[model samples]
Target: MRVTIDEDKCCGYAACLSVAEKVFDLAADNIAAVLVEHPQGELADQAREAAAACPTSAIILLDDTE
Candidate 1:
């Protein structure tokens, strides 16, 4: 799966970072960004959780087939 964050929608709440620090990081602009293009196994689960946890729903997970 591919993880992405909509900068315009992100509020820098850092919930995603708290949920999956390995896959999400706060960029210079203080918004969350993807640390990996494709996360595998447990990391993938964490990424999904992070996306769901995002208050603004900024984090998005695009399935490989999508």
Candidate 2:
């Protein structure tokens, strides 16, 4: 999966960080950022949850596991 975050849509809710700190983090601008381009195993699961937890829907998951 390809995790992408739209900083503009981020509200600094830190939901992503709470769920997937290893995959997502706050940038210098205080917006959500994808730390890992693609996560696997449990990290992947958390990433998806993080994306869903985003109030602004800043997180976008692009599945490339075909």
Candidate 3:
């Protein structure tokens, strides 16, 4: 699965980090960033949870093609 983050929508709440720090990082501006473009195995599930946990809905998950 591929993950993308909307920097403008991220509030730096660190929800994503809580779910998967390996796949997401909280920048100095507090916005969540994609540490890995494509996550697999357990990391994929964590990434999904992180996206769902985002209050701002900044994290977006796309299929392999996307």
Clashes by residue pair, model 1: none
Model 1 misplacement above 4 A: none
The C-alpha local distance difference test score for the whole of candidate 2 amounts to 0.88
Q: lDDT for model 1, on a 0 to 1 scale? A: 0.89
Alpha-carbon deviation at 65 in model 2, angstroms: 7.0
As for lDDT, the candidate ahead, 1 or 2, is 1
lDDT of 1 by residue, 22-56 (tens): 99999888988789869999999999899888999
Ranking by TM-score: 1, 3, 2
List where candidate 2 sits over 4 angstroms from the true fold.
Answer: none
Deviation in Å, model 3, residue 22 alpha carbon: 0.8
Per-model TM-score, in order, reads: 0.93, 0.90, 0.92
